[model samples]
Target: MSTLEIKDLHVSIDTDQGNVPILRGVTLTINTGETHAIMGPNGSGKSTLAATIAGHPRYRVDGGSILLDGEDVLSMSVDERARAGLFLAMQYPVEVPGVTMTNFLRTAKTALDGEAPSLRHWTRDVKKAMGDLRIDADFAQRNVNEGFSGGEKKRVEILQLELFHPRFAILDETDSGLDVDALKIVSEGVNREHAKGGMGTLLITHYTRILRYIKPDFVHVFIAGRIAEQGGPELADRLEEEGYDRFTAVEA
Candidate 1:
């Protein structure tokens, strides 16, 4: 089974003022077939943790370690991390102006698998996955995220999650801006992948609505870049009702 461990991770971002600390001693472990939800208010260093795991340059690893199956993930480059089976579905997936969805997905899959999938089967697989996500058939021809609605863009992110089938998926606020129907659809797509097993998940979000659908095995309440509390599904229910006042007040 695969395992991704974050051990006392400390991360910082460069700012006009100076290097600003973001993730301070944040640690968590996600093993194959497990789902861990990290929920907190905005600016609690949630996305910074995700971006750091995915090796975004702006976020510098100031201290601590991230290990994948006992190998050092902190040393891997962004693409290398992907090849190592770590995937991050960003909250804002960028537009690739010249890249059609088909080409982008195909290219990414090829790079990850180290072999180009056969055209016939690849086409069929893409179509089926798209259909599963309720994506329009014509999106294959459209430029990636170009002229797409916010919900559509988020659905495409889930499309990548389904198609890539990574060993671990770090979804950063995937439910943001999605309507109830879109949220359910995206959550179901994630659930489909989770059901396949050997897929670890770290779902980060401000609200607990997605948890109602995705159902995390553990719920961690993050405050000021630290895990202030942890519990089972009931924790999520509590957060939905009580909000983050307790956590944020503690941070204050």
Candidate 2:
């Protein structure tokens, strides 16, 4: 099985005040067939960790290493990282004005696989995935994420996850703006991908609602950019009842 390892990861961003730290020596490891949930309050650096892993330009890794199966992920460019099988489903997905979803998916798959997928199989798979996610068939012909609602964008993100079949996926608060039905649909999409036993999921969120559908094998509490506590599914239950108040108090 493939493994994604993060060791003593310290990340920061340049600002008017100079570099400000966001992730303070955060470290975690995820293996294929496992699901990890990162739970925390606002400004706790959950999304920062996700962005750092996906090689986002805004966040700089000042120290530490992100290794994918012993390969140095920190050294790889964003596209290189993606080609190496890391996928990030952003919390706020941006719109691509000119790219059609159909073209984008096929092009990305070709890049990732180093060859074009068979057109017939690709079309069938995309249609099935979209249907499973309850996405309108017309969406394939539309520009990427253009005019889609929050839930629609999130579903599209998962659609990519299903089609791309990355070794690991970092979902940054995927359930944030989804209603109950949309949440279940999106969660089911993730579950379907995870069930394949080839993809590891790093699900970052603040609530336990999504946990009901996408159960994490490990639950980590992110407080001030560091994992303060980690446990099995039981930890999520505790967070649901107690919330991050206790963790914040401890951090304070």
Candidate 3:
């Protein structure tokens, strides 16, 4: 079974003043068939944690280690990490003007599997995933995220998640910029993936609405780049009702 483990990870970004630390010894783990939610206020390093795991070039890991299935992930290249079954759905997905959805999905599948998917079955699989997300059939022909609405872009990310079937998926603020209907659809798609078994998820969000549908196995309160509290689903409800005031005030 696939598992992701982060051990006292410290991430920083390079600037004119040299490296500025962002994630300070943040650590967590997620096993297969589980869902973990990370909620925090803005600039609390939620996105940085996710991006660092995905090996984004902008973020540098100054300390700690990340392992996937007992393999050292911190030592691998970004594509290597991806081939090792780690996926991150960005908060602000970029628009690839010339790459059609079909092409992008096909390339990703090819890279992940180390072989091209059968053309005969590829269309069917893409169509089925799109249909599940309530995406129009014609979307496959459009350039990735180009000219798409906020909700549509989110759905496209979900589509890629379903198609890729990564062992661990880090969804960063997926519920952001989505309408209630769009959020439900995206959450439903995630639920379907989790039910497939052996697929773990790390969902990062500031709101609890998506949890109403996806239901996290554990909820962690992230404050100041560190996990302040962790508990069952009730933790999510409490945060939604009481807000992060009590938790933030303690540190302040």
Candidate 4:
């Protein structure tokens, strides 16, 4: 069964310009153990779709439904959505000055589990996740994302992904601002998670390079505020060859 489903979703945000619509009747579904990729040009509503799924306050869902594991997601609060097994990896991770990584992770772990992990077990799990991501053990003591490089911040997000082990994840531009080495590392972490059962992913990206490392079962092209095209991996190839010109024209 599909773990995540977005049906005829309509999203808009209040801007000085007006009620700017970002997603217009967007619909998609991702089953467990599958990876779906959403590709689009700038202002095509890809990121807006991701943020809406994550319960961002600014991106209001004017219509349609989001379901996770057959439950209504639109009714859930942001933290409730997280606890209900949905994760979003942001393009721009915020830095916290005083909150250490360890503390932040522990809080998240506790919140998701509804109980605290024993000290010994918690330490072991945290160590294992960090090791898998090649993050140093000492990094847990640093403030969350503070003074971290772009690659490092992305790794931290992946670390959270591993820790949360959500049923589904929406990675919004996770490959952006990464060097070759960092991209490989991030893709490797996502691969590792997918190798485990009961996890689906929706990877929102503009470039096809990241798709080379993380092959998607489905590829969707978004233009304006709706899907312009969709298919298998071959769809990604077509986009690479033709660019977004055709889709943009359709949008127009």
Candidate 5:
């Protein structure tokens, strides 16, 4: 099985006040078929970790390592990382005004697989995945995320997750702005891939609500850019009851 290992990761960003640290020596591991939930308060560096792993230029790696199946992930470019089987479902899925969803998905799949999928099979696969995500057929013709509702954009992100089938996925606050029914539909798409026993997941979230739908194998409490505590699913239950105050010496 594939493995993603984060070893003492340190990330920072430039600000008017000068460089500010975000992720402070974070270390964790995720394996194929496993789901690890990173729960934290806002500004606790949860998104920073995801961005760094995804090779976003804004987040600078001060020090540490991110290994994907023992390969040096930190050395790879953003596109290189994706081609190597890493996926990030952004907290804010951006809009591509002119690119149709179908074209975008096919192009991305072709890039990742190093060969174009046969048109017939590709069409059927995309249609089935869209149906599974409850995405309307009309979206296939619409520009990517152009004028999509929050829930719709999120569903489309998961649609990519299913179609791309990466070896590892980092979902950064994917539950944001989702209603109950939409959340369930999105979670089912994720669960469907997870049940396949080939992809690992790092789910970054703020609430336990989504956790109810996508059960995590391990739970980490991130506070002040570091994991202050870690445990099994029960930790999420405790967080729901007690909140992150216990983990953060300061107010959360």
Candidate 6:
């Protein structure tokens, strides 16, 4: 199985105030078929970690290395990371004004795979995935995320995850802005794709509700740009009961 390893990663971003450090010597490893959850309060740098892994331009690597199967991921370009099987589902998806969803997905799949998928198979697979995600068939004809609701955009992100079949998926608070029903649907979509046993998942969220549907093999508590605690699924249960009060208290 392939592995994505982050080693003592330090990251910072430029703000009006100047370069501000967001991640401080953070490290983790995930293998295909493993599900890891990152839980923390706002400003704890969960999304920063996700963006860094996806090679976002806003975040600069100050120190440390990210490796995907021993390849220097930090050295690769953003699209190179995706081609290398790294995927990120943003906290807020942006709209592409002119690109239709069908064209966009096919183009991306072609880029990732270095060839076009068979028309017959691609059509069938896209239809099946959209149906499974409960997305309206007409969404295929719409521009990417254009005028869609928050929940719709999030589901579309999972649609890409399902279609692209990345080795590692970094979901940055996908649970946000989703109601109970949408939450279950989106979580089930993630779980369905993950069940194939070929994709490692890094699910970042603040609540335990999504954990109820998408169980994580490991749960990490992020505090002040570092991992303050780590444990198995049971740790999620405890976090649900006690919240991050104790951890933040310790940090304080």
Off by over 4 Å in 3: none
Using alpha carbons, what is the TM-score of model 5? 0.98
Using all chains and alpha carbons, the TM-scores for the candidates as numbered come to 0.98, 0.99, 0.97, 0.97, 0.98, 0.98
- Give me the overall lDDT of model 1: 0.92
Query: Considering lDDT, which of the candidate structures 2 and 4 is the better prediction for this target?
Result: 2
Local distance difference test scores for all models: 0.92, 0.96, 0.92, 0.92, 0.94, 0.96
Candidate 2 stretches greater than 4 Å from native: none
Q: Is candidate 1 or candidate 2 better by lDDT?
A: 2
- Could you arrange the candidates by lDDT from highest to lowest? 6, 2, 5, 3, 1, 4
Which scores greater on lDDT, model 3 or model 6?
Answer: 6
TM-score comparison, 4 vs 5, better candidate: 5
Candidate achieving higher TM-score, 3 or 5 = 5
**Tens-digit lDDT string for candidate 1 (34-145):** 9999998888889999999999888888899999999999888889999999989889989999999989999999999999999999999999999998999999999999
Error of 6 at 32 (Å): 0.5
Could you tell me how far off, in angstroms, the CA of residue 33 lies in candidate 2 after the best superposition? Answer: 0.3
Better of 2 and 3 by TM-score: 2
lDDT of 6 by residue, 16-134 (tens): 99999989999999999999999998999999999999988989999999999999999999999999999999999999999999999999999999999999999999999999999
lDDT of 3 by residue, 1-252 (tens): 778999999988999998788888888999989999999999889999999899899998888999998899989999999998898989999999999988899999999999999998998888899999999999889999999999999999999899899999999999999999999999999988889996899999999999999899999988988899999999999999999999889979
**How many residue pairs clash per model?**
0, 0, 0, 0, 0, 0
Superposed model 4: Cα runs more than 4 Å off? none
Alpha-carbon RMSD to native, per candidate: 0.8, 0.7, 1.0, 1.1, 1.1, 0.8
lDDT of 5 by residue, 151-217 (tens): 9999999999999999999999999999999999999999999999999999999899999999999
Total colliding residue pairs, candidate 3: 0
lDDT of 2 by residue, 1-252 (tens): 999999999999999999899999988999999999999989999999999999889998889999999999988999999999999999999999999999999999999999999999999999999999999999999999999999999999999999999999999999999999999999999999999999999999989999999999999999998999999999999988888888788889
